[model samples]
Target: MNVLVTGGAGYIGAHVVRVLAQHGHTPIILDDLRSASYERIGDFQHEHVALEDTSKVMAVFQKYQPEAIVHLAGSISVRESVQTPEKYWANNLGAGMSLLLACARFPVRIFLFSSSAAVYGNAVETPIRENAILEPTSPYGSSKLAFEHTLHRSAQALGMCSIALRYFNAAGAHTAWGVGEQHDSEEHLIPKVIRALLTAQPVQVYGNDYPTPDGTCIRDYIHVVDLAEAHVLTLENEYLGNQHNFNVGTGEGYSVLEIISAIATRLSVTPQITFLSRRPGDPPRLIADPSALLSHVGWKPVHSSLQEIVNSAVEWELVRC
Candidate 1:
């Protein structure tokens, strides 16, 4: 499969590109290197094209004529989105619109979206379902959800098959492939803790006084490799029709303190931790049902255990250092 991977140079996109290559598919990367690091892209065949650049995007499409498009390009920061909403709206929604329009006009058939769990911000329930109310609190999440809605309508209009895989915490690295998480500004917990722990710095635990048993906020951490596998399965499946949505998670929740403890145990170091006030718009607990993905998509998480996740991240961080 000749696939056009938007944001194929970034953290998650790199992992997905690696997975696609391992699965015997050619990934023609399209990344502007705006927030992406070139060192992380390694030897993947890619083009310097922004998502909103229709001419450049069309040129890449003409070159590859990709059978599928794994759309991973976008601005992805809840806090940053809150601070600069116009940036989020432009990059996330606007760039996505460009690709969707191209697909509608071009020969591209399949579109796999990298959606977010932030779409269900401050959920009313613990284990969020596919049918759960989508009340995104931040512009980032809203932008992703808005693109999904457009994807549905555009798929019907273009006669293309689209799937939006709503990801939870996509942590860890491709330990075997040696391509792991590498961000210009580290925000995800696993990498942040790994960097801090290695440097003998204290990691701040935000608001450990929540209602949960550990009093810290709980989140569903999905291994990057597992997420890549889900994309491979869904994208390769020949039964996709108009549109589909799946919440990609392990159906497990780990609190902030638990993650710290796991990192401490895995790395054999006493982590220096500091508790701070909770960041607003953060849910106390957010787990996934994930039943729809298994039954419908024939997929389930195989590398999402907390110990394995922490271990992979620690290994990648150690190797990079």
Candidate 2:
């Protein structure tokens, strides 16, 4: 399958591209290089084209004529989205519109979206299900959900099968493949902890007084390799018609303190910590019930163990240092 992967140079996208290649699928990268790191891209065959450039996007379709599109391009910072929603609305929704229009006009079959678990904001339930309520508190999540509706409409009317994988805390790296998480301003917990370890700095533990076993906020952390494999399995499935949603996770929750301890143990060091007040909208526990993915696409997380995730991330960070 000749697959067009938008944002193919990104942290998750890079892993997805390699996984697709490993499965004998041709992944044609289409990244604007705005937020993507060239080092992570390696030697994959790619085109420097933005989705907002309709002419170039159409040209890409005409050139490769991809059978499927793994749409991963977007601005994905919740904090920044709160400060400037127009940017999210423009890039995530607006540019997404341009791509959807192109998909409608093209002969593309499978449209796999890289959606986030942030769409379910501050849920009152643990192990969130697919049928969980849709109430995104941030503009980032809103943009992703809004685009999902448009994709659903396109699937119903245009006859293209779309699947939205609501990812929960995509961490770790595919260091063996020479691609890992590298953001300009690090936000994810694992990478932040790794950086603190390398620099011998104190990692701020927010809301250590939460109602949990360790008195810290808990979240589901899925390895990037497992997350990428989930994408390939869904794309390869023959299920047709309608837009489907699945939670891509290990269905296990790890508290923030637990994650910090895991990384520190992996690196053989004692972590410096400072407990602080919880951030607004910080949930006590947020985990995914990924049974839907297993039943529908025969997908199950294989490399999402906390130790392996920490080791992979630590190896990649060590290389960077």
**What's the lDDT for all of these models?**
0.87, 0.89
Task: Give candidate 2's error at residue 160 in angstroms.
Answer: 0.3
lDDT tens readout by residue for model 2, 111-214: 99989898998887878998899898899999999988888887778788889989999998877788888987888899999899878999988898888998
lDDT of 1 by residue, 88-200 (tens): 99988888887876786577778999999999988889799988999999999999999999888888788889889999999888766767887778788888887888888
Candidate 1 ranges beyond 4 A from true positions: none
Pairs clashing within candidate 2: none
Clashes of each: 0, 0
By lDDT, the best candidate is 2
Candidate 2 ranges with C-alpha deviation above 4 Å: none
